[model samples]
Target chain A: MTSSAAATIALTDVAARRGNTTIWDQGSFDIPQPSITAVIGPNGSGKSTLLHLLLGLLEPYSGTVEVFGSEPREASEQLGFVPQSYHVPGSDYLTVLEYVRLGKIGNQFFWRSPKGMDQQVADAIEAVGLAGYERRRLRHLSGGEQQRAAIAQSLMNQPKTLLMDEPFASLDVRHQQRLAELIHGLRMDHSIGSLVVVHDLNPILPYLDGVIYLLDGHAHYAPTSEAVDEDLLTHLYGCPVQVTRTAQGDIFTRVTGHAP
Target chain B: MIELPTVTVQENWLEILTADFMRQAFIGGIITAVAAGAIGYFVILRQQAFASHALAHIGFPGATAAILLGIPITLGMVTFTVVGAIAMALTGNRLNDRDIATGTILAFATGLGLLFSNIASTAAANVQNVLFGNLLATTTSQLISFAVFLFLICLTIAICYRPLLFTSISPEVARARGLHTGRLNLIFLVTLALTITMAVQVVGVLLVFALIVTPPATALLLTARSLPALFLSIGIGTFAVIGGLVLSALFNLPPTFFIVSITTLLWVIATITRPQNA
Candidate 1:
């Protein structure tokens, strides 16, 4: 099947399995370039599996998954990923400068820090608003700062697209808003589009241009306004879900019922 | 109650330094310390302390078998440890599975060492030396082997520093970035095996942690920067070896005993004085 030429990510009838269990199958979606898209789904709806597929960490059972007009693995250099957990092993001893410098590493024989690597690391840190945190240990940073440092590490490659897995999982609302602004700023200044996997979509609803919601073993994508319908969300969640707008024109979603 | 050995410093310092055996012990101990210090950082970073301990025991049979065959003990130790490392690495990245594999292999290797030692009854002392180390018995040929192994380890680490650090911390991200994480894991385990083989010569199989884990573990308590921590680990390892040698000469005790004691004391001190939130 031919994918849209302009789409940054295109999945055609993609299916994924974990062990003997089929997580999701018959999934198809397209995420355009220069857009902030949220990948939202209920727990175990294969939200992370979708990110893994795009990052070329998993194989589709019987479908084509493309990123930037090529197989996901072939376009890995053009993509950056922020994993769900920031608790990396041995990160306790890594300074911000050292950890951020890791992003410059690729599949290379010898590791010679490129000329101006320090400046580039500094720039990435500054871009994340972590300007004076170069010498701070990752374990010493607050949750929001750690998330920003992870973002800075991802940006070291100057990736055209970023894939973040649950970037707001443990953050307070204020930090979440700040992260939303950072994502928006990345898109505006660096033209780096983001496909963020999130459980609660309200925190990022203001900046999100589109969403890819996984449900009933399929993925569907739509613009934010088109996807925010109460019935659609209620059906997707298999519970009573209410999508409401605040007085300041902000979108909020609340699950009005307990687990079925 | 066991009686302690008489504390005596009869040998002149200059004369002790000039002795061939003393020189060999110092050289061998220093080389082993350097390799252990460098690799122990990663060992701790990767949380593979158990595997590291297992690798040393896995080499025990090899050393005993080499004694039975009248071959170089280091060669046999390297062969067994590297093979064991490959087997453990093949078990994939799950710590639980890897530990099970390492423990299983360790059990079998210990059984084999017992068999080899039984067959080479006349060389029981040699087997004892392998278990607890006899650094003074390190031959010139074995010293050469230690130097060569140290060079290879340093070279490989230098060439693969960034990726090694990257994979050690966040393997999923490294794999996503197109790094061959499996191959890197294989390389790291092999290097770790080599370091274990060398460390076994100084502290022997049972006390390998003295050089391989304790120093780095202590260094980690004091600092949160990679380079500084690594250097501090090396310094601690070096000090333990030299101090152990000197104390052994003064007290007429086993160098391994002093080495382990010094490292354990340092680790205790570091733990007590460890910085908060570091």
Candidate 2:
């Protein structure tokens, strides 16, 4: 575990609530820099709530939430976000290039396009393996391609850390693997860490360096290897879970069945 | 039986074009069309068609109040619509809340309009003109006012274009990017109110959708690019206005009727023939 001083994200006794209902509390964790971490929890487990706290979309009910030792809002420029779903009305007509260019929008004058904006947009798109697809309308792309386009848009901010909420949702296994590989590549090539909220962790399990799991109204953090224990996961999900290892030493977990 | 004008082109085309009323109608119609088309692009993109429709009704009371007070109807309409828009914007970004706020305000404005119209029976007779519009009757001052309103709309849109687009498309991301989304919402709604005010002059409250919604809807069906779609929307709106006016001159019919018909027809055609992917 990285010390708090070197952590990219640090939460101390953080408690989150929606209205009067507490989602989670007493959450303390330090996510090391340049690592891919999975945020796994059952439905309504407040996995998304945790991400919102980090993005400053929601305030902690108590305690403190910090990104890079500052309030999330203060360090927003260094962060990028991908929502669970992105659907813009009339965006069916928006080209990939136009959509990606939106990431560079800051508190700037409307008339001034950023200098070297075209090259920056192109570079971001290429980084997400969406080269030659810039001119295509968003509606024409497949689901996986659209997902990549979304990642490209976030990369336009040149963010040091990315917060993706359910990036793997609705994607097929092949696409999920591709996205997981992309996430890993970002850590390796750009030293960008990601905290991804996900339901199924199998596709991403092999690539994750750490895990933040929400269970029984509390968050627990551990290295991926330690977090993949069958008994711990069974307790985390309240179901029978099976952890397996491939010959290549990759680890994955599957929920075996519900408790009888 | 009402006499219908002969379909034959009896008047010289140049003579009709040179007439003062015709010139004013052309200029005023084109200006209103441009503003509507530009603002309508974002309106459609933001899925605020209901809010746009509600603002027109909300302006009715303002127009009636102006008539009773012996002020310019445009002033009253602008005053009420702008106020209504700000209220709606303050209701937060939730579509459900906005619709409820808009409907409640629309209901109150309609009641106010009725009360004002009944109090001034003579001026109440002009309410029909406000509802249906009388483009050919536009005075020089009204034309100039339309020009001014158009300028304001253009300036606001120019200044707020990028943020407005960003917020409308992906508000969460925009907020995360440090945009003042609430402020942008206020600016957008006010600009929408201004556009609706100008459009009400050409098409009136009842048929305002012709200028403000149909052209942009059709433009969206044709292209996915912002600039091209915007220009196409303006072009289509301009064509509908001018064509309706020309047709009205030929038939001695109401230009509003022709304008609505032309726009509706174009929307139908575009919808049926749109690309498979679109």
Candidate 3:
């Protein structure tokens, strides 16, 4: 694990509320650079809310949140966000290539078109393993392919810190593995610190370096090895959980009183 | 000064182009079509179709109010719709409750239009022209205003194209990327209000919605790329205007019926031959 001195995202005494309900209070955590941190929580445990706080889309009711030791809003250039529910528009007039070009809109001026924008877009798409799919409209792509295009859009910005909300949801096993490998490669090569929200932890288990378990509006920070244990998960879930290691290096967990 | 072309009178469709009023209407229609088609792409992209429809209806009261106050109808329409656009922008930012806010604003605007039209007895008698339009009666000054508004629409699109697309496609990511979405939204609303006001003269209050929505939507079926779709939308709009005007001149029918009919017909053709199940 990287030292806390290399933290890319740091939150201290941060409090946030959505409408009448409080999401998190006095939430503090530091996400180290060049690492993968899996954020796991139940339905109402403020997983999505934390991403909003980091992105400055929602203001914290109190305390401070920082990205790269600066305010999140100030450091927006270095940050990338992949929302959980991104779909191609029904009247999709945008090709995948054009959609990804919008990624650089933030960093560039309205006038003075940047040089080699096409090459940059191509490289980003290729990095996400979507090279030939550039000309296709988003509506023509499959769900997994659409997700890849979304990732390519984010990757085009070359962000130092990537925040993915439910990156593995609804993905088949092969696509999920492909995404995991791609993300792992990004972390290794670019040294990008990524915080991924996941409902099922098995797909990302092999790639995770750290874990943040959110329970009752507060985060329980732990290393991957310590956080994935049966006892810790059982207590956190407020129910019996059976965790067993399989031959294929997978730690499968079954919550008791739930179907197999 | 440029020499104006003199045409030989003939019993053909081109004969209608000889009349000065017909020429003015044609120019006004072309200008209005280009503006509506260009701006309509963003409207469909952002899913603000209902809000845009509401904005058009909001101009009705402005027209009636202008007639009652003895001011230029275009001036009142611009003032009222701009104000209505601002109100909608403020109240419609909340995702879940925007439809309600838009509905309330639309109903209120319609009510004010009826009340103001009734108060101005002379204008009330000509209210059909305000609601259904009289394209052949367009004046030079009205055409100039359309030109100015069209220029402004183009300028805004040129400056805000990238960020606007970013915001429309993904508001949260755009915000995270440090875009001033609120400011962009306001600028778009103002531009839309101005464009809608210009459109009202050619197509009237009730029928302007067709031009703003149909062309761009039809273009969506033709192309999967934005630039092509934009150009196609403008092309379709221009064609519909020209076609509708010629047909109206020939059949002695209301231009609104022809304009809306041709636009909807183009959309139908597009839908039938669409590449995907759009």
Candidate 4:
């Protein structure tokens, strides 16, 4: 048996409830070490809920979640998070530089904010392709640029693992490429393990290493290279689907009745 | 009649500065400005202004109760306000939309205020100081107390400002970063309770409203940059307060009315130049 210590996320029967209604129930997953995984499903399949559980933002009624071999809060020091509204409040009034500085503020909760935190801030902003827009107010930036500022905020602390929920929604094709490029570089440069929840699977097929196909309480796990084939995809999707693979290994999942 | 140096600040400025009442009014108004602007900024960010208003009204009953018992009223006011804040914080999911709770507590507190005032040696209408305001009557000792308390409150805000801002903007993100957002919220509310109690004593309830809302609201419009926004609001607030106090002295009217009117006018001019989006 392999040593289980290196696994990043291991959840055992995590359940979430809102008042009387249950949002997610008794779900479990083993997220691989040092890799990018997409937790994908149709709408309301608890993708975001699973991420919250991993981040320790939500508690389970009857389960344990070990993120990086510790409780979510303990593991959070090495964890970075981005949500759907990444450009949420507190960014509107702040310059791109000041917005990223907030990410470093968390480091001061246990220790004083170091004098050199500005260098870390600059490095994070540079990593997100926002070197010149450093002093721009977040409101002055386009949606894509604002998102890059948010990415800079998440990357400011140099977290070992990053959990992003829908970081690419509502962006044009150009910005999407820029974001993908940013992700690619961060992975190469820092080897930062990332789990991003995305609605459109096609745009992201180029970046994913593994996929978690969720249907109600059940889940199917597969490597992007192997399980993303024509037969395997249709079964997990509960639809007649076909995967048209280009000779260069690009994947496109088209519904059976639809013309490609 | 003695020719004091024919000076730089327009023509009528020296006469206003020479008046003793004008000086007192100016100092009092400035103190009121700093207190109100600082508290109101948090009130808007936390969306707790209505709760603050309710606490002000709720203080009336507690103050009246204390007066009837021949004791200091600030104790009852602070106690009830803290209770209300703690209750609101701990309710969890049931009271997610805060307005409903604020309204309910407001109605209850006002009714109690009315009841307590009614049973006094005087009637409900006679306690105008509690319902409206009476800033003109603030004594020197009261002013000194205000300065000390204001310094302490601002110091506390300075120490915890970032986390407070984080929690105010997005509690989920704050929680993820391992901040005790709920506890921090209670601590802030407690400080707010202390502040409202002190302000209620000087400005009265109605004037307290002007102090808490107008300066910060005007500041939010005048400046887009964060640090500059705060400084601009304080500066704008100082100008309004000083001018209002001068006018209050010359015209013999309530300082609160003058303060609000001038600040509101400033806000109007700002809105004309600074559009909705920016």
For all predicted structures, in order, the TM-scores are: 0.93, 0.92, 0.90, 0.83
Ranking by DockQ: 1, 2, 3, 4
The alpha-carbon deviation from the true structure for residue B167 of candidate 1, after best TM-score superposition, in angstroms, is: 0.4
Clashing pairs for model 4 are none
Q: Which order, best to worst by TM-score?
A: 1, 2, 3, 4
Task: Report chain A TM-scores, every model.
Answer: 0.93, 0.94, 0.90, 0.88
Please give the lDDT score at residue B224 for candidate 3. 74
What lDDT tens digits, residue by residue, belong to model 1 across residues A157-233? 88888999999898998998899999999999999999999888898888889999887888888999988888888
How high is the lDDT of residue B1 in model 2? Answer: 100
What are the lDDT figures for the candidates, one per model? 0.87, 0.86, 0.82, 0.70
Model 4: per-residue Cα lDDT over A1-260, one tens digit each: 34546556777776666566676665676776667777777777778877777777777666788887888877876778887877654456666876788776842433367788889998898888899987677778988888777777777766877888888789877777777767767877878878878766676678778887675665555688875777666655667788888999787777786323
Candidate 2 matches the true fold with a TM-score of 0.92
> Which digits, one per residue and each the tens of the lDDT, describe model 3 over residues A1-260?
34456466788888788998888686877767768988888888888888888888788888888887777777777777888876636325578888888887643446666788788899889888888988888877889888877777887677887889998999999999998898898888767768899987878888888888887777667888888888877766777787888898877677766422
Model 2, span A21-98: residue lDDT tens: 999888998887778999998899999898889888889999999898789888787788888876665556678988
Clashing pairs in 1: none
Predicted structure with the largest TM-score when compared to the true one: 1
Q: What are the per-residue Cα lDDT tens digits for candidate 2 across B53-152?
A: 9999999999999999999988999999999889888875688887887888788888888899889899745788788887887778888888898898
First chain TM-score, candidate 4: 0.88
Query: Candidate 3's error at B261, in angstroms?
Result: 2.8
Candidate 3 backbone collisions, by pair:
none
Top model by DockQ, which number? Answer: 1
Candidate 4 residue A180 C-alpha distance from true site, Å: 2.9
Q: After superposition, how far is residue A15 of candidate 2 from its true place, in Å?
A: 2.4
